[model samples]
Target: MSKIDVDSVGQTREGTFKYDWKMSALYNLGIGA
Candidate 1:
């Protein structure tokens, strides 16, 4: 939960690039699995 909050803050501060990358990576991992 804490890590998620940090990620959310990062998304806000760093913009969408890192967020999108993380989402895409998770999506691909889910698909692969």
Candidate 2:
């Protein structure tokens, strides 16, 4: 089977999703933290 590009995950029109503090905070807030 072909390999998937892990770096492409969470890509969007705005930009690629990075695992930075901003994104982590957003995720936590999104989950009602």
Candidate 3:
């Protein structure tokens, strides 16, 4: 793939992982942990 394509894909993956982490952290907090 082109460099631009690779860069976008990497950025999207990083954003998705960060969002999932934040959601899980909020869930844990809601459960009193």
lDDT of 3: 0.69
Better of 2 and 3 by TM-score: 3
Cα distance off (Å), candidate 1, residue 3: 13
lDDT for 29 (candidate 2): 98
State the TM-score for model 3: 0.62
Off by over 4 Å in 2: 1-19
Q: Deviation in angstroms for 13 in model 1?
A: 8.4
Kindly report which residue pairs in candidate 2 clash with one another.
none
Best by TM-score: 3
Q: Which tens-of-lDDT digit does each residue in 1-33 have in candidate 2?
A: 012235446566344444445567888999999
Please, what are the lDDT tens digits per residue for candidate 3 over residues 1-33? 255455456467777577668768888999999
Candidate 1 Cα outliers beyond 4 Å, as residue runs: 1-13
Task: Determine which window of 10 residues in candidate 3 has minimal summed lDDT.
Answer: 1-10
Candidate 1 local lDDT, 1-33, one digit each (tens): 466657677366466567767778898998995
The C-alpha RMSD of each candidate to the native structure, in angstroms, is: 3.5, 7.5, 9.2
Model 3 Cα RMSD, Å?
9.2
Candidate 3 ranges beyond 4 A from true positions: 1-11
